[model samples]
Target chain A: MESQQATQVVLASRPATARASLENFRVETTPLPVPGAGQVLLRVDTLSLDPYMRGRMNDARSYAKPAGIGEPMPGESVATVLESHSAEFVPGDVVLAQTGWRSHVAMDAAGLKKLDVDGIEASAYLGVLGMPGFTAWSGLEVIGKPKAGETLVVGAATGPVGSLVGQLAKLAGLRAVGIAGGPKKCAYLIDVLGFDAAIDHRSPNFAQELEAACPNGIDVYFENIGGAVWNAVLPLLNQYARVPVCGLMVQQSGTLQHDTSADYLAATMRAVLTRSLQIRGYINYEFTEQYFDSFLREVGTFLREGKIKHLEDVTVGLENAPQALLNMIDGRNFGKVLVQVRSNASASRS
Target chain B: MESQQATQVVLASRPATARASLENFRVETTPLPVPGAGQVLLRVDTLSLDPYMRGRMNDARSYAKPAGIGEPMPGESVATVLESHSAEFVPGDVVLAQTGWRSHVAMDAAGLKKLDVDGIEASAYLGVLGMPGFTAWSGLEVIGKPKAGETLVVGAATGPVGSLVGQLAKLAGLRAVGIAGGPKKCAYLIDVLGFDAAIDHRSPNFAQELEAACPNGIDVYFENIGGAVWNAVLPLLNQYARVPVCGLMVQQSGTLQHDTSADYLAATMRAVLTRSLQIRGYINYEFTEQYFDSFLREVGTFLREGKIKHLEDVTVGLENAPQALLNMIDGRNFGKVLVQVRSNASASRS
Candidate 1:
């Protein structure tokens, strides 16, 4: 595939605000290079488009480095090994790689994790068993420190991390109250995800709805989105409530500027004071060193036993990567969104 | 004293915003009555003027009750028992009570803690040996968990809580950086309080000053004033920073808001995610049931040993109580402001 080239999206410019157009990114066809002595050539199969990517596009200090201008956007992708000079992998083995927004790329063998797609689809590695799942698992288990009778409230409830958070809360004997944008996600949260209560944030009476849903104020609020959703959830948090904040996708849309009035600081501090709340911010990678083993074993077992259900909105081909990512950023993606870079025709039959 | 009525201040109306004025209070000269079956007739000696009273002045729900209309303002006071009908206390005994702003009050013996002055002034019970000091101690020791070699940054550095926080951080072998308004308070923090670094929040380059002071990013930020000071300090916060928010006195002055700009929240969230920052709000009362004994023993000893220094700005009479409290809310009080309602000429001396 070296002569045929690799497809990747690179940052063309920085976004000024929430209304950033797709013109900020450009797709480039580059020559795929041969693997080095300890490297493997990955044929990208599924790419995970996450909300955190919005933070990477801006030239600001965050948990990770911003995607530099003219760099391949950072992401996680499930790939198949097309060629391997490393002893660790075979040519036809399926793997997960950091080769982002691409059809084919060469990377160190150490960077890839070998995958088993037994009963689950290969794309499941990008959703249920991948970064999002681990992010939710680690944040909830470690920082949240949820107890059996405690109530756990999570926003973006239908998304990969949030869906698992609500379900995991229930599995741990905590009341799970899921907050989602629309009725559809709310319905799915109750019927499919088995959340104790689901509130539609789209409703005008969202604050009241959330209060009604959580008669016993929330003990742990898994803060994935921080905007009006946070405003609605803050008052309902119980004393000593633990908020493990992992994502702020809801604030990416410039709504934070509009929503955060002059009293926003005072209001937030008041809530902090009254509730004695613990609002912790975490990135999945920081906890990975300590939590990866437990997460891998427990999540793997849960997936195998059909205890945790995962959903994905898969898009085909490398050409549609930009729009797929855009759709995901706009919250249009129903679950984890992935791109099918190259079809594994035989894997479906196997 | 019973024949001559005692003066009492009552809450006339609730404040909407920064509109809280002395006009919202009314002083009534009511006839003093004898103590009930299990109560004591106490002469108020000192009243604590804390910034948190601003919250109580408003009708909003908080950690404590709002001072109701026509009801004497709720407060913590060191009073001398003039008449006792309860088996727990005798006449002329100095005790602490949660009575409102009154020259004399009829109180239950169960609602009071006996004062142990020892080598400390009885007035210190309303400041360093009381709630303010306990607040700093509990938050720093329990929530901030100041580890040796870590840097602790406290805003409103010269206040009762912040002053003690800086000193306690020092005692724990942690570097203490204090942020206070003006050159004088900054000087007091370094000279009198013995903080490792003291920066004036009033400086034009306050953020830069804080950055230069804390070469190692802040680990424990005792958030007392959450406005511009917080914005300046937020960027300097290191990963795993424990922010034990005590009060937002600066914000209560009806000043600046949190930097809710998308970029700011994005940056804050990124820092939190990357560093695993833990921001927990706390009230000293929560720890009283757990740490009161150790606190009373340790802090009590520190005061006797001259290890902890305390400052107070006393407003002479009961008539000056409103202005004293108002000044405290406005950050004009140099230290703990006490209203001497009655003299303790014949009380047991330390």
Candidate 2:
């Protein structure tokens, strides 16, 4: 395996703002590592591009460590185990690994989860069956706890996390209101994803539209976009509403000023005192150990039975990863952004 | 009963700022009514003043209805049952009721809670065993989940809710850091109440003092006073910290200017997303049914064993109720603000 070469993207510098240029990344070739005892050597098939990766570029303290300068960009990936010295895994087995922004990686079998893509695609393990899906599931079920006849509002409604969140709410017998940038995505949410209503945040009457859609008031607001959408949703949240803070995609460039957050916080506090609002924040990793089995069972069943549906915005090849990531942060990708490094001939059509 | 006159306070008008004058309240006398079936007529003995009442004075929609003009001030109070037509209670029985700012009230027996003073003072029910105590227990135990070795910070350190919160956190094996208005209260928090450290918010070096106190970073910021105290506590909170939105006492009178509540909210949302914070808002009523028995047992045991010691700022007579309430909101009350309308010989010496 030392003769085989691996392609990797390294963080060249810290980004000052959202206009993160590719000059901050350098693709390098390294000798593919051999599997040590209890470790597996894997060929990466697809790397997941998420909004959280943008935070890693900055030298700020986050839930996870910021990717230091010159380190490989960290991310989750779906890969095939090429060779393994561990009893748990074998060659030709598809698995999920933290191979990060690379075409190949060698890691202990303990950290890598075996992906059972029997009738499902391996890339789905990176999105709906992976972190993004679990984020939606945990935030909604554990935090939001949206009940039947209640309202749930989620921004970036067409993205992997938000789309699944809205769908799950609808399935839970609640009114799902989706907020997306364009009229097309809004239309896609209502027409295809079965959300009760879709509010186009790009529209001049975005706040008004959101107010109109959430007639019963927003009982559960999955706060993923914390900028203008937050301002819009603030007044409409019902008494005792639940706000599960999932992401802050809109504040990537620091465009949204911080002055408005405190009033909302005061109002939210007042609401909590009066209405008993519960706003809890969680990363999927917290629940991974406890809820992994149940999440895989429930969400996996939902996907296989077509009870839940997800769209993909595939960015083909390792070279397009940086651009794909940029697009993801900018809301350019319509769904889960997947960087397809290698493909199986049989699974290509799907 | 129809000939009996009841003195009450009405909302004369709304104030523009924090310096609410006596003109804001109009004192008037109205005829008392007789109790019908399943009802009790009560002579008020004490009224509990809480920060939430400040929100009701404003025209904003909250968990409860705003105080209407020409209506008596709303509050929970301890009273002697003067007359009753229900089998649930008899005349001379002491009980707690939401009788507002008045000398007497006619309430449904079902609406009143029988006050079992047994070995404790009646006013203690309004502070420790009542709403404020429940607020602390429910918010801290259910939301904050203060663990051993973790630090818990709370503002308005000498007040009923905050004082109990600190004591409770200490009992749970967590270090308690308190924030109070002046040096005297800070002294009480440290020397008397046994808080690990107390920062005087009114001091010139408040922010620095707060930062210096919490070496481990605050694991539970039991937020009540949402102003400079929150500003100081925000950046110091550890990852995965819990913030129970209990009150916004700092913003009660609307005198705050150039206040960074918006920035705090944005930061809170970002913290929630990146750090996975659990910021929950709770009303004591929501948790009463579920935890009341356990609270009575726990808090009752603490009080009997002298594990918790508290001070009472007793305002003797109903005539002083208005000023007492105003003082409590202005941080003039050093401890639990209890308006004593009637005397009990067993009252503990202050």
Candidate 3:
């Protein structure tokens, strides 16, 4: 049999601002990598595109290392083991691997987690049953500390993390109020996702709508998108309110250039002092060691029971990843964004 | 028997900025209050002047009601019960009361906490054993979470709260670094208070000195005074650092007029996200229900064993309280500022 060719997208350039464009990525084809001893050759099935990828594009000090120029843009994917040289993984085995924006990868078996997709879809592991889902669960449980009857406010409501956060809050007996960009996302938050109230952040009277949604002030704010959403939520935060900050979607594009007249830092600190507020910033992986298994059990049960719902926006082919990522960052994608790298015949095999 | 008059200091005006002048205060003579049913007539011995009072002076919404125009400025005082109409106290009994800036007061017995001053001085309750001490204890324990061998940094080192915080950190087996305004105060922090290192904020190489002191990077920052000191400490903060923000001394005087052109607010949030930091703001009273008893027992013993030391800048008369408070706010007062409202004749009875 002739050797197969693999397509990979590499970071061509870093965006000067937070706004990323397709021009920043370059798609190239190379020979499929051969599996070495103790390694498995993966055929990428579904690639997860997240907002955090924006931070990795820039050469800045962050939780993770920057995606180097001329290298594949780093990402997690649900892949099928096309060939195996390891005792752990066999051919046709579906697994979770950090395969980046590539069609095929030869990686050590130790790096791949074999997936047991008996009753669940393989792509679900990339969204609701995966990192994004774990983010919502840990941040809410550990930092947000949802108490029954309290109101919870989350931004980017239709996204994987935000939607799951609202559902979890509702299950925990909290009043879940979601803030989304458009009327459609807002409608989905309230009608489909079971949020108590939904406010369109793009509305002219956003602050007023947010206040109306949360009759009682926000007790826990699941902060993902910062900037105007944070500004609106600051005054509405009740005494001893907890804010579990996971992502700042707005600032991920670049450093904010705000009007100089306001001293927002001083005002924020003042609120923290007077209201006894707790603001904790975190990344989900920090809790993986302690809480990952618990997350899988709890959230998996919720998903299996039809208690929590999720949505996905898929772009066909690995070459469309740059556009998919840009769309997700700009809030054009309504849910968890994924790049379908190949047909799921191998992933569906028992 | 001749009726005695009481001299009281009242809030004459609110400061337009953070700078409060003596003109904002007025001294008045009123008839000594007569104890009513379930009441106590107390002669104030030492009045505690704290930083929180500046926030109360503003008419803005906060945790507590703002000080009303022409009302005696709210404060905590250690007093001698000259007469009692309740079963809880009798003549010559020392107590803690919310008697404001008055030399004498008639208050309900429900509000007064009877003190058992054995080896500790009665005035000690107004400083090291009182609100400031509790502020340090509760903020450190509840928010700072100082672990053994971690580095703890505190501002206003010679003040009641900072001094106690450093001492407590040392006791907890953490490296304690203190920041103060002048050479004398910095010297006192290292020599008298047992801080591992002291950095003078007045020095031109303040940030460099702070970086030198905390070789391991700051793990916990007891933030009471916010301004240049906070700016210096921010860059040196380690990942997952905890900041218990009790006060913003510079902002309390007025809005911070910074020389930097960049948006500090955006920078701060970015740091919070990148570093996974925990920033919490609280007042001591918030922890009074839970941690106050633990603080009194632990710190009270530490004082007895000479494990911790305290200093007081006592002004002679009640008339000088306005000046004393101004001095404290301006960083001119060396330690905890207090007003000797009356003779210790009744206090010496214990």
Top of the candidates by lDDT: 3
User: Lowest-scoring 10 consecutive residues by lDDT in candidate 2 chain A?
Assistant: A253-262
lDDT of 1 by residue, B1-350 (tens): 33367888888888766757878888889888678899999888888777667778888876577888899888888988888888989987889898779988888889888898778788888888898899999998888999999999998789888898998889889999998878899999999999999998778788899999999988999988887777788788887898998887655565545555534544555566657888888878889999988888888898999999888998877777887787776667898888877644422341
lDDT string for model 2 (A1-350, tens) is: 22377888999988777578888888888888777888989888898988778888988875589997888999889988888899999898999888889888889999978988876888899899888899999989888887999999998789889999999999999999998877799889988999999988768787788898888888999988887788777778777789888788766656444346346666656666656677777777888888888888998888888888899899887777988888777656788989887745523542
Who is ahead in TM-score, 1 or 2?
2
lDDT per residue as tens, model 1, A125-185: 7777778888899889988989999999998889899999988899899999998877888
Computed on alpha carbons, the lDDT of every model, listed in order, comes to: 0.82, 0.82, 0.88
What RMSD, rounded to one decimal, does every model reach?
6.0, 4.8, 4.3
Q: What is the TM-score of chain B alone in each candidate?
A: 0.90, 0.85, 0.89
Q: Determine which window of 10 residues in candidate 1 chain A has minimal summed lDDT.
A: A255-264
Error of 2 at A222 (Å): 1.2
Model 1 stretches with alpha carbons more than 4 Å out: A1-123, A145-152, A181-186, A196-219, A254-262, A315-332, A339-343, A348-350, B1-123, B201-217, B255-277, B314-332, B339-350
Error of 1 at B10 (Å): 9.5
i-RMS of candidate 3: 1.3
User: Per-prediction DockQ scores?
Assistant: 0.37, 0.50, 0.58
**How far in Å is the alpha carbon of A157 misplaced in model 2?**
1.7
As for TM-score, the candidate ahead, 1 or 3, is 3
User: For this target, which candidate reaches the highest DockQ against the unseen true structure?
Assistant: 3
**Candidate 3: docking tier:** medium
Residue lDDT tens for model 2, B125-220: 898888888888888988898899999999878888899999999998999999887678888999999999998877778778888898889999
